[model samples]
Target: MRFQLGWSLVWATLILAGCASSRPAATTSGRSAVDYNSYNEDLSSTRPVYNAPLTNVTPVTRSAAPSATAPAPTATRKNEIRKPNPPIEALHVNRELDLILDTIAIKNRTVRYAPGFRIQVYVGNQRQDADAVKLLIYQNFPELSPYLSYNQPTYRLKVGDFMRRIDAERYYASIRRLISSAQLQADKVDIRRSLLIK
Candidate 1:
């Protein structure tokens, strides 16, 4: 009975210690308690009130320190707003550079075909297999133009007239999901078709 009473006393002491807070009470020292009702009055008294008219106030102009040779710049009035000069319309070009650019553009325009990339979806002897793959690509990606051509015994199925290999790789990745045989190949791409497809 004595042992049980001692354990109960220890538990009671632990419970009391856990429940009791050690933090000190909040103190205001000498200042009075903050009154929320006089917020506007307190704010007004603390803020510096400006009596000057804002419309007449000119912005202080910052400039480089004046040299003896350079004349002092005239003071700008608040009302006298300076409009920015119109943007330069005419572009000055170097005659030699302009000629070379024009030549390159003309040459590119005249070229109907260029060595580029095409995503070959399938290449086999069976025409039906090629047609099936083409149909699959068409259904999944309507934007991609699939072409199936028979060359002698073998049939070829190619998709997308991509000028760059990077572009061809992008389409190949998506097509690979549907057709395992999809491959990126180098071919003469019609510039018009490539541009239109993109």
Candidate 2:
């Protein structure tokens, strides 16, 4: 596949070069050698690896940073929006919490490296409908691999394979800060590797 992709790229480059304008305009008609530089067969001329050759480009201005003369705009702390404090007795050290911890233990799983790790960072049972979710992923994360898990009672959708729990947790925290209800779930929910197409 990698070999085929490279071959395709080479052919594409050659084909594009062959089709470019090569007829030189008469110098007497206000044309010069400078204008034919693009038509020149000199492959020694530098071309960019990723973007188009020199074309109309506008200079980008980096906006000025706020000066010390003005007070910096304050941002609200994430995780500060507390749910109505659950009853103090309800906060007692509980077995379900311990069980939740046990389920996420990386050392306990028989992970198949062929399919990759069993651990995942994000999990949630969300209320957003399929259309809304499709919109969210399209608008916010157009690159994500999307799949729907429709079992008898629930339909779960997931995105991204995060290996380490810490990385996943950090991502989860950042995501939650931006969108409320992005919650963690017990690790018993299965994870599958994505097979992305070129």
Q: Which candidate is the best by lDDT?
A: 1
* Candidate number with greatest TM-score: 1
- Model 2 TM-score relative to the real fold: 0.29
Please give, for residues 1-198, the per-residue lDDT of candidate 1 as tens digits: 999999999999999999986755446685445556777544776789866433433354455676698555444454443323323342334566788899999988999989998888888999788878888888987777777788898899888888988888888888888788778989888888888865
Which residue pairs collide in model 2, if any?
Answer: none
Compared with the true structure, what per-residue lDDT tens digits does model 2 show for residues 152-181? 556565544444455446556655664565
Tell me the alpha-carbon RMSD of every candidate.
Answer: 14.7, 27.2
In TM-score terms, candidate 1 sits at: 0.47
* Prediction 1 global C-alpha lDDT: 0.76
lDDT of every model, 2 decimals:
0.76, 0.50
TM-score on alpha carbons, each prediction: 0.47, 0.29
